[model samples]
Target: MAGGSNTNNYGGDLSEVVRQLAVVAQQLARSSINNGDAQGKLFKKVAQSTPPTYQGELDPTILQNWLREFEKLFGAVGCLENSKVGCTTYYLKGEADLWWQQNEATIRALPGFNWTKFQDKVRDKFYPSFLLKQKAEEFSNLKMEEMSVTKYYTKFIELSRFAKESIAIEKAKARKFESGLTIDLQLKLCGQVFETLDEVYGRAAHLYALELKK
Candidate 1:
């Protein structure tokens, strides 16, 4: 009788363990399906929105802002190659679609329209190769005398996009920004440690504003 009771108890424990594992597996499967469906729905919504138009030239600041919004939407929706098809569908219908229609020749030349690569092509088209050297030179020779602190800082950020290779590191960007400031401002900022280009800009701008008030 004792041996029989022990066998029964062991069987009950084994059944409980199996039941728990089955529940966990079912939950995991449902979660995966739900996540995929959610992403698909998001992608569809973005595919139906107004698409951005690219003229021969894009305002660097506005282009960057638009790209950021697009990246967020794309990332939320799994950023798949099929998303490129949806992008084309969304873009090819509006007046803004003129850009897509015009650029179709370039688009067809790509091996395949991967969403990320498609975005890169658009960026290259609007950013332009000739502006690269000009932007770098502008950033390198930025002067506090030519523009207000805010304007100079804004231009610095816009130009940095073109010279990303040179200012790829945060420290390099900070140093480059400081180099463009007047000698007095640079001297004032010399002892301060800054973590980002923006922080340097803010500090320099504050000092310039004080000087203006004085």
Candidate 2:
């Protein structure tokens, strides 16, 4: 009796042998699929174990976005404490890498390099106090007229980060965002209730799209 064969002296039966071979082949195929699935899961686990690399030059807002992604990635990986060295040098590229090289000695000399404090240092280097103030002023004076609705909203959101105290509440942020829109958009949203800045932006974007088609 070969593997997967009956004990009825089935050796002389070619059909029985063929049937057993087919069954064996099917079992092998199933095992292969199971192994492939296990390997796929392992690959995904390893890939998500580390943060994604940061590419290109550094700007205050751009670096901020990168840090946000880095935080989320490492937090998910359960390695937030190792963030200082693990997230910085390994993932840097282009101008960011050059900046790291130039400041490597000073960075290494810091007594206790806290990631949050290091972020502040990077922000200060790119967006000084004066520049933040200027951006806040610009955000305050921005109007939707003559500018595309998307650009106006994007600039508002970008500058709003520095104006932390001003747009702290969703209601206040929504009001400020609405106030910056064109009179037509304001009139369109007059009777609507928006709970967040994002909601207001959504409605305003829809109205702007309609306005464009008219």
Candidate 3:
């Protein structure tokens, strides 16, 4: 009968629609699983790097070193920008973990929160403004004096972090470093066209060695 033929055609169309929806659901499930697996792999890579733990140390140097270590590891592993705070916070223990837990919700609620913001927050919490100013002053007054070229260079590099803007550019860094060297060394390096701190350091070291021999 014609009526029976119409019912069969309608049922066939309904079944095909259901089948298409089922296929889409399956694809979505597979995509979700793949994404989860990739995230797990990335986290594992971060763990293998053995990132340092922060325990709410009051020492600015310790906090700065810990932050620097994480920065290095993040660069080495090619960590995702969105995931950096999560990864770094995982290494928090003791008082540091407690502080993060207490403030996590509020910090997360802020608009446009990211790694740099996180760094600023941590510094604000741990690094006092007066101490930072003092460190900057020490860097400004640093001089080679009797220190060997290598030792002076080491100190310069260490203190430079506190006064980043002073030597933000290569030429300024070279000039600032040269200004701290002994008068003899400065005279030797004067009127030269050094473009970088490293170039100035190399020439200074070579000159210092020659002076030691003489």
Candidate 4:
């Protein structure tokens, strides 16, 4: 987010998107003490309550890509700890769309992929351009099925939009079905977050990129 040449020339939403992302990562780290508390009960309830927030096989390759980019991006801050947390495919690639975003541009830019290494090697070439350079997964892939290799990677950033939003919708539905662990728990949790995390996701630039247009 600093000024000058390295200042995310993609402009507007991109830098803001990255900044908010950094804040999110930082906040989660800062609030881990309470975050763990919030998680312990909520997760158990969410899992057993009703509709599950998570479903389907998250792409391992994409998660690795996210972890690497996370390391590269947040590494500047020196806050990201426990390589296991960042390295795990589970958190990083919770949904398919998130994985797509971590490697969307490069996958689209190249004519074809080295399928064998496609999942792992993506970590090597990540850059700002990967997220900013526009590409669509729908048109990039040649296969008829929507999830085919070529098409799958193309729509990552755009799909990232979906992946992020899906969590809110799903979580809300879960809360409604599960009662959100009673009112007291909810308020206490909110209080913890208000005191801990830097910013809420919706207010984060990544959620409002269109409004921040340069």
RMSDs, each prediction? 10.4, 13.3, 3.1, 26.1
In angstroms, how far off is 19's CA in candidate 2? 59
| Per-residue lDDT of model 1, residues 119-159, tens digit only | 67666756666666777777777776767878878878877
Per-candidate local distance difference test: 0.73, 0.74, 0.91, 0.38
Instruction: Name the top lDDT candidate.
Output: 3
Give me the runs in candidate 4 sitting further than 4 Å from their true place: 1-162, 167-181, 187-214
Between prediction 1 and prediction 2, which has the larger lDDT?
A: 2
Compared with the true structure, the alpha-carbon lDDT of candidate 4 equals 0.38
The deviation in Å at residue 44 for candidate 4 is 43
Return the TM-score for each candidate structure. Answer: 0.59, 0.61, 0.78, 0.17
**Clashes in model 1: which pairs?**
none
Instruction: Using TM-score, give the best candidate's number.
Output: 3
Cα lDDT tens digits, model 2, 109-180, are: 787777766666566555567766876787788788888888988888877886888888899999999999
Better of 2 and 3 by lDDT: 3
Q: Candidate 3: global Cα-lDDT? A: 0.91
lDDT of 1: 0.73
